[model samples]
Structures are given as C-alpha cells and as structure tokens.
Target: MVVDDHPVVRDGVALLLRGEPSLVVVGAAESGRTALERAPGLRPDLVLLDLRLPDMLAPEVVAGLRTGCPQAKVVVFTAHGDHHGVQAALDAGAHGALLKDAAATDLVAALRRVLRGERVSDPRMVPGTAGNQAALARSGLTRREYEVLRLAAQGRTNPEIAESTGLARNTVKTYLQSALHKLGARNRVEAIGKASEAGLL
Candidate 1:
C-alpha cells in the first residue's frame, strides 16, 4: 500500500512501483485513518507511508499499521527528514525511513531491503552519518530544545516560535536558553552558528 495525502505523490509512487516486476501496489490511501481502515482487507506485504498526514502523525500511523497489519512491513517515505516525528516513527517500529528526495533506484533498493526484514534509514537522517543525532547527543539537547533551536535558526523570534509550536513564550525562552547553554553559545546568533557547524540545525 502507498499512503500519502498528496494525490500526485500517492499516484506517482504507485505508478513507479507498478513498473517494478518484484513489487505490486495493492492499495493507496490519502490519510492515516483510511490506510488503517483498509490495511486489513488489502493485506499488503509492505506499506509506503508519508510522515505527516492531515489526520495523524507518523508515529500514530506506524502504530496503527503494526496493530492492523502485523504481517506487513511499514516504511516511512517523507520529505521532512530532519523532523523529530521521523525518529518517533522509527522508535514506534517503522522498518525504515527514506527521504523523498532519494533517487528512484535508492528508494527501490531501500524498500527491497526492508521487505527482506532489514531496518534502513536514509544516510542523511542517520545519526553519525550526517552528524545529526550525534551532534544532538553531544550537545545534550532534548527534542524540544533541538526543535526550538531549529526554529530560531530559521530567524523566528521567541514569540513566533511559541506561536508556531503552540508553546508559551516563556517555555520557548527556556528551551532556547537550555539549547544555547548546551551548545556553549552566548546568544541565539552564536547558538545558530554552532548548531549549523555541528549539522544540528
């Protein structure tokens, strides 16, 4: 099954897989709820799931697929490789996570590996491979702190970050302060620079 909210992406993936002799696109769904509801009946061998859906996040979708179709492997196919939701989905038992920007051959290879029971993550999304998770760990920054720092790096003010994240202004400030201290930076500007250098932003 292929699950993505965008019609073009959903159909495009399905079309691509149909061309591969080793694979079959059994079903396509535009949302997590629809995918879960249809998965049992479809009985697909694997699912290509988007990380963000209008109705649910990646982790929730992965959990539902696990329960509803335990026989099928779940692989997250997303554009937001750096989003914390990707990690959450992987932790929730997704077999693999591949970035949408990957070449078609790479995507097919990764999917084949997952179908053979191997866990795969895009190199850019992997910890030490891209210095993402390693940098995050070395800095001792929590997921929230990393998220806030990322937003700050994007030139968002504290209030804007709070509004975008649905967090209180003070909470955003505290997260930024913690992130700054962990990165050994004196202010947001320095923090952003250090994070960029470490590949954490």
Candidate 2:
C-alpha cells in the first residue's frame, strides 16, 4: 500500500513498485483516513506512508496502522525529513523513514530492509548529521525553532517568517528567541552565523 495526498506522488510510487518483479502495489490511498480504513482489507505486508496528510499526521497514521495491521510493517516516505513529525512517526512505531528525494534503488532497498525487520532512516534525517544533530541534539531546537531561524538566515523579518509559516508574529519571535538561546547567540545575526557554521541553515 502507498499513502500520499498528492495524486502524482501516490500513483508514481505505485507505478514504480509495479515494475519490481519481487514487489506488488496492492493499493494506493490519497489520505491517512482512507489508508487506515483500507489497510485491514488490503492486508499488505508493508505500507509506504507519507508524513503529512490532509486529515492526520504521520504519527497518528503510524499508530493506527500498528493497531489495525499489526502484521504489517510501516515505512514513512516524506519530503520533510527535517520535520519533527519524522521522529514522532518513528517513535510511534514506524519501521523506517525515507526521504522522497532518495534514489529509486535506495528507496526500494530501504523498504525491503524494513520488510525484513530492520529499522532504517535516511542518512540526512539521522540525528548524527551535522545540521540535523545540531538542531535536534546539541542545540535542542524544535522543528519550529529551526524553521524560524532558517528564515531569519534568509533575511526574513519576524512578520515575513510568520506569514510564510502561518504563525503569528509573536509566535515567530518566540521561536527565534528560543533558537538564539539554544544556539547561544545574542541576536538573529549571531544565531544565523552559528547555525550556518553548524550546517543548520
């Protein structure tokens, strides 16, 4: 089964898998609700899921799949590897998480590994990577804080960051402040510099 909100992505993945002699694309769903509802009947050995759906997040979907299809393995396929939702989904019992930009061969291999009972994560999404580790481990910045800081690095003001992220101006300010403190920077410029040096930009 493949679950993604985008028609192109969902169909594209299904088509790709169909070309594999050892794999079969049993079903495709455009939302988490649809996937959860159909998973039991489909009885797939593995589910390739996207992190963000219109109705639910990856963690919620992962939990549902775990309960509804305990025999099946769940792997998150997403573009936002840096999103906190990736870790949340893994923590909620996803067998693996792979970035959408991964090569087709790598994606297939990762899925196979998960089906064989191995836990996998994209190297870029791993906590030990410089940028990701700095934000998640060393600095302890949340996804929102990192996002706000990245925007600030791009010279975006608080209002711009808020508008882009759909967060309130004050909320954006708070995130920036939190990021600055975590990075041990006194201001946005210093924060940006430190983050850039740490490969967090």
Candidate 3:
C-alpha cells in the first residue's frame, strides 16, 4: 500500500515497488480518508505513507489504520526528518521511518525489516533522540501557539480552527505557519505533533 497526496511521486514510488519480487502495490490512497476506506479491503502487509497529506496528519493516518487493519505494519515515507515528524509516526504505532531521499534499495530493506517486526529508522532523522520531550521543548512555543497547535495536530484545517476557536481564519493560518517554523517542523503536522510530545496540547 502507498499513501501520498502527490500523484507524480506517489505513482513513481508505486512503480518501483511493483517491480519488487516479494512486494505488491495492494492499494494507493492520496489522503487519509481514502486510505481508511481502502486499506481494510486491500489488506496489505505493509503500508508506505507520507506524514503530510492534504486532509489529515500522518500520525492520525497511522493510528486510524491500526484500528481498521490492525495487522498491517506502516512505514513512513516523507520529506520531513524533524524530531517531531519521526516521533509522531512512531507514537502512532508505525514500525519505521523511511526518509523520502533514501535510496530505493534502502527503502526496500526498511520495508522488509518492518514486515519482519523490527523497527527501522533513518539515522539522519535521529537527532540524539533521548526522548520526544526534550526535542519538543526545543521548539519554544507559547501557550496560545500550543492551543492552535492542538487543533492542527488533530488534522483540522485553518477554516476549521477558526470555527472552533472563534479566531479569524487567517489568524489560525498565521499561527500554524509560525508554529511550524518555531518547531523546526516542515509542516503543520510535525509542529502540532511535536507539541503533543511536549505535553503542550
């Protein structure tokens, strides 16, 4: 299974995986909602997912599938390598993290390892990871930022956050973007996720 919102990259990766003698591209979903709908039917042994999607956080994606298809091992394939990004996937029960820039051979090996019930991590993604707490505190966010972060962590859109918080939609977006930069996160998902690790949310 492959879950990514980018068509070109998703199709390209899928094409490569289809050539593996021991693997099959059982399903492809561009977003979490579709993944939840299709993953149960596909029953894939492993899932290759991106941590950022158009509709939901990747951790949510990982957690959701654990319920719908409890047996599948998930491998995160994403451009992000921030501490928050890596920890979020692991906390969501993912078996591994494969950076998007990793070689195809390495990606295959990670998949095999995860399917074998072992954890696989990209070394560069491991920034002296004593624990998520220390890493998250390094993000330096304020209480209000943490509030906005909690909603984003749950996969709410800027518009959704405005509705929930009574803030202007643009204000929510500004906070999310600012939070991302503050956390050294590449996206809203990673920022909010790191916040969760720090018990900020």
Q: Each prediction's Cα RMSD?
A: 3.4, 3.6, 9.0
Instruction: Please rank every candidate by lDDT, starting with the best.
Output: 1, 2, 3
lDDT of 1: 0.86
For this target, which candidate reaches the highest lDDT against the unseen true structure?
Answer: 1
Clashing pairs in 1: none
After superposing candidate 3, which stretches have Cα over 4 Å from the reference?
Answer: 131-201
| Clashes in predicted model 3 | 0
Candidate 1 segments whose C-alpha is farther than 4 A from its true place: 126-140, 150-170, 193-201
Query: What lDDT score belongs to each candidate, Candidate 1 first?
Result: 0.86, 0.84, 0.78
Q: Write the per-residue lDDT of candidate 2 for residues 67-176, one digit (tens) a residue.
A: 99889899999887656678889889998889898888888888889988998899876332544654466668886788778778778888877766668899998998
Candidate 1's TM-score reads: 0.79
Greater TM-score among 1 and 2 belongs to 1
Residue 108 Cα positional deviation in candidate 2, in Å, after optimal superposition = 0.8
What is candidate 1's lDDT per residue for 67-95, written digit by digit as tens?
98999899999886656677888899998
